[model samples]
Target: MKNYSILSVTCLIFASLLLVLGCKDDTSGQQNAAGQQLAMSLPVVEIPTKTLTAYVTYPASIEGVVNSEVRAKVAGYITDVLVDEGQKVNRGETLFKLETQSLNQDAAAAAANVNAAEVEVEKLKPLVDKNIISEVQLETAKAQLQQAKSSYNSIVANIDYANIKSPVDGYVGDVRLRKGTLVSPTNQTPLTMVSDISQVYAYFSMNEKDYLNFIQNAEGATISQKIEKMPKVNLLLPNDSLFEEQGTIETINSQVDPNTGSISFRAKFDNPSRLLTNGNSGKIQVPKTFEDAVVVPKESTFERQGTTYVYKLDRENMATAASIVITQEIDNLYVVASGLKKGDRIVAKGVSQLRGATEIQPQEIPFDSIAQPIQKVFR
Candidate 1:
């Protein structure tokens, strides 16, 4: 009986040990499976070589081809605003009318003086002819009549100046002086402005270095020839939309601005629709072409300490962060200058979630699917 009890206790102890070991083995297997599933599945693509055109943008200001300020010829209170803002007017059309009541009164008084002088000269003419008065007296009356006529003409001219007229055929700008506002030629502010919008000018600037590069790269010996050879440029509107009409490089300032250390350039665009007006602001985009350039999607790039990097993949699908130097950025692509080559495999997305030497299951994708469509690229 004692041997049977000891054998049963030994069997129970051995069974308990086996159960604990089995549970530990199962837990270990589950941990290993979970770690295997943690490796992320990311998309990748091979770099491409293509001819791409990039744009270098600079701030631009829009103005009408002809901008003329409308000023009052004589000082007077404004009585009539003949034109409204943005109203189209022809040359010599009335723009504003100043109060002319005082001028009219002066004109009437001068006319009466002329009539009196003429009557006195006529009365003296007969007396001089009859020898009733000396010839000197008649000559004196004639001189007074001439002076009165001159004064009358002067007053009449002033009354005509009270009606201000448009100097050019254009659309009117802001009316600075309203009804009852006094204005004159010497006043700093103009009554209004008129601009011809049949065509427009887009003025932009380039630094000294860029100017030098542009002239040297152009295919011409003279500045005028270079401008003719330059490609047509595009304007980006204030809302970030591209202007429908393209512009040509019309003029390059002969001298650089001493204060800004930059040179100004003027581009002209046909404004048949009158969409552009004076004081409008936009950006000028100059196209630059790169032949057989190695390009990458900007999405795959990451910056670290001022250095740009990309996750380049090897045959084993292991990603290594490699530094790259970018030459230019076009829309959604980067033109690489160095540190990367054509046909190199790179991670397409999720670069921030990756680390160096990380192994990934690379799902190959088309470059176009990863990169945004380029805008206004020629070829």
Candidate 2:
């Protein structure tokens, strides 16, 4: 019995030592992975140097070059409606006709007075030639004849003014007057409107800061030269579609609005199809191109306290947090102004799991593959 007890104690001691050694081996294996093994394995790409274009969009108000209010020259009831709304009209085309019965009656009375004055002048001219009457008497009769003739001519002019005509070549707007509607030159309401929409002007404003930057960057010494060298601007319609025709900068307001601190700009566009009209609203996209710009993918960056940061790989393939300054922005990418240069390598993806100075197993890949995934971009 004593020998059996000794044997059990020996077996128990051996079992305890084996258990302790197994636990030590497990702890050592876990230690090997800490700082010794990479925290994450992610694809990395080198920065690309290429030309890129960034667009700045501004809201704009559109109007035709000519928008004229059609009004009546004389006071009278409309006798005839000649032109339809939205109809194309030429200069001096009759749009409406005013009642001329009263004007015609006045013209007849004036004509009779002119005839009577002519008779008096004829009778006096014979007497003057014979010196039967003083020369002054004939001269007085001639002056009276001239006055009557003037009255007659004035009446005829008023008759012609009864016909309302279009002042320019354009499309007519809402016709407010119909047959029997009384109108006059000084009436509060206009007969209609005419808009020459063969071309349109887009009006927009820029803040003083933006205005200064634009003028300084333009390639010219004088304002006129700068305007001429300005690139064409694109129009984005309300539907978020690009207008087929591009526009050119026409003029800039010499003075800025003191209250708004903004300067006005106008751009002209050809509207051959007459699709654009007065009161249309749209956006103008001004393009700015950068040459040999260093660009980085937005997917590889994260913002900290309003500052953007990216994880760049060091010589030892460890992660290093870098601060980059962005000058312009394009789709899913940023045009780097500073902090990084061409051929610098950065972690492309899986950056949320990493921290600064951590070791990483880098899987080198093409920049496009990381920035623009084929599934997202192509599809």
Candidate 3:
């Protein structure tokens, strides 16, 4: 029995030592994990207060100040084409000459009738003065002469109409007629088009909702007053290049097109280089400037269930999920409307790898380093 008790005691002592060793191993493992959790490496940015401009781009149709379709007034075969496409022309410049041979023949016959009527009037005048014939006969001869003169004038006008002239000082558009092609006022196609592009007009449409908002935001007591106070706009050419010259909003349609549910707007842009041509399509960028707005990088924000959030680093370098109300989105940046202010630091990148309340190792970067240049944003 004593041997049995001694063996039992030895077994208890061995089990106790094993339990102590297991506890020490678990404590050491926890300590090692805590020590390894150094601050997470994250690029951060301080919220900045600056003037930010937000723009919305819409497709626009370019047109010259004047787009005149030069059509033939008199029907005849095109005998000569005087101008080429893209040629700069002035008002009254002849663009095409039509064959007036038939017109000339008609004019010649009308002239013969005019001459015969003149001779008849002269022959009757002397007799009427001498009382050799009734006064009614001389009056009838005079009326015949008047009718002949009218016929001659009509034929002359038609002959003059054979010369097609440009109605404006502008560049020539597509020339649809060549020599031997017949054109006239009733023809469905025009001989060519003249576009006065010295100042070009860009036509764009704004939906009713946007139009109302735009006018409301503009500073003025009336619609016209608001339009006058609106800022200038920029154009994005078809090649994705920006136009050097800026444009101003000139006019808006009086009523919205019921079928389209949008109002048309015309913006005038000076085209000294003649780069903007008729029928050229591009985009118009209208910028709305926000002064002293709190801005943040859009990459730092994440959307959850339609709400946008970001990891904002506090004084202790701990990340807190902040829900920000954005007033506008400008390229890769956001203008914060609320929930954040200037001087608040945010994780510029790597926000997806962070969890709330976790500490961060901040790598601060300049605001411009993360966002586009201010001039580019507006330009």
Candidate 4:
């Protein structure tokens, strides 16, 4: 009986030892798995600020100052097209030619008649002076000479119209006609279009309130002075890339567009190389006026229902979604003129997963190259 009791006790001790060992192994495995799941690194970024020039962007289109479509005035078969598409042409330069054989013959005939009448008038003048011819005869001869001279001039003008010429110096657009194509005088089908692209114009619109404010402020200001100190204009290309150069406001529309509730405005830019052609659409940023402002990265803000919100890091590194009031600046960035103060740590990125009073590990990200430049402006 004692041996049986001892055996049972030994068995209980062995089972306890086995259970303890299994627990230790399981705990160590859990620790290893957790260590492996940890993030390899935390994100860090550089933040700096400087004074930045601000711009207000709007949609705009480019147009040449001088644009025209060259047309044929006289009807005839197109004998030759002197200028090719995209070729540069100058004023009075022949662009195309029409066969003017019939017109040329008429001119020649008129010239002969004028010469014969003039000769008869000269002979009759002497005869009238000598009283060898009556005064009425001399008068009749002079009238005939005058009429012939008028006819000659008319035919000469018609012959000149046979050659098509460019009225301005510019690049030719499309050559719609070819040699031997019949063209009509009334139908002035363009040979091509020409434009003086040495300077380009940009047209844009402003809201009625903005337009009113501008005029009231610029009432006594000179256009040149206004342009020099006037709001800075930034031009963006079709690719959404901004032009390195800036432009100046040239003119404001005489009246507001009733249909659109906006006032139109124009800007001028020197395009010496003719780089900006007609019909290019892009965005223009115009800095109207200044105000005491605070700005933030647009990505950090969220919109819910009708309000805009941002996530801010508290002392405990907890993200709290806070409501903010903002005004749009250049690009997609926003100016948080209110609802944020200096030195507040706002989540500049990755705020979508966060909620109010949520505990989170904060990671800093580098300012994008585009965003980096704007930081300097704030300082």
For this target, which candidate reaches the highest TM-score against the unseen true structure? 2
Residues 198-246 of candidate 3: C-alpha lDDT, one tens digit per residue:
9999999999999888888899898798789889999998889999999
- TM-score computed on alpha carbons, candidate 4: 0.72
Write the residue-wise lDDT of candidate 1 on 89-157 in tens digits. Answer: 999999999999999999999999999999999999999999999999999999999999999999998
Q: For this target, which candidate reaches the highest lDDT against the unseen true structure?
A: 1
Off by over 4 Å in 2: 1-39, 370-379
Residue-level lDDT for 6 in candidate 4: 100
Give stretches of model 3 more than 4 Å off. 1-44, 313-317, 360-369, 372-379
RMSD of 4: 6.7
Please list the C-alpha lDDT of all candidates, in the order they appear.
0.93, 0.90, 0.90, 0.76
Candidate 4 lDDT over 1-379, as tens digits, reads 9999999999999999999999999999999999777322222223233244466678999988888987777788999888787788899999888899999899889999999999999888888888897999989988999999999998888778888888898888878789999887667566678988778899999898877666666635665565456665788998868776678887777787889989888988888766788888889887644354466667677899988987766787666788888655545456665777756766776667665576666676654532543334443
lDDT string for model 2 (1-379, tens) is: 9999999999999999999999999999988868476457889999989887778898999998999998888899999999898899999998899998998999999999889989998998888899899999988988988998898898888888898889999999898779999888899889999999999999999999999999999989998999999999999999989988999998999998999999999999999988899889999998899999999999999889988888998898988999999988788888898879999999899879886687888999998875562355542
Clashing pairs in 1: none
Task: Rank candidates by lDDT, best first.
Answer: 1, 3, 2, 4
Q: Clashes in each model (backbone N, CA, C under 3 Å)?
A: 0, 0, 0, 6
For residue 211, give model 1's deviation from the true position in Å.
Answer: 3.2
Question: lDDT of candidate 1?
Answer: 0.93
Would you give me the overall lDDT of model 4?
Answer: 0.76
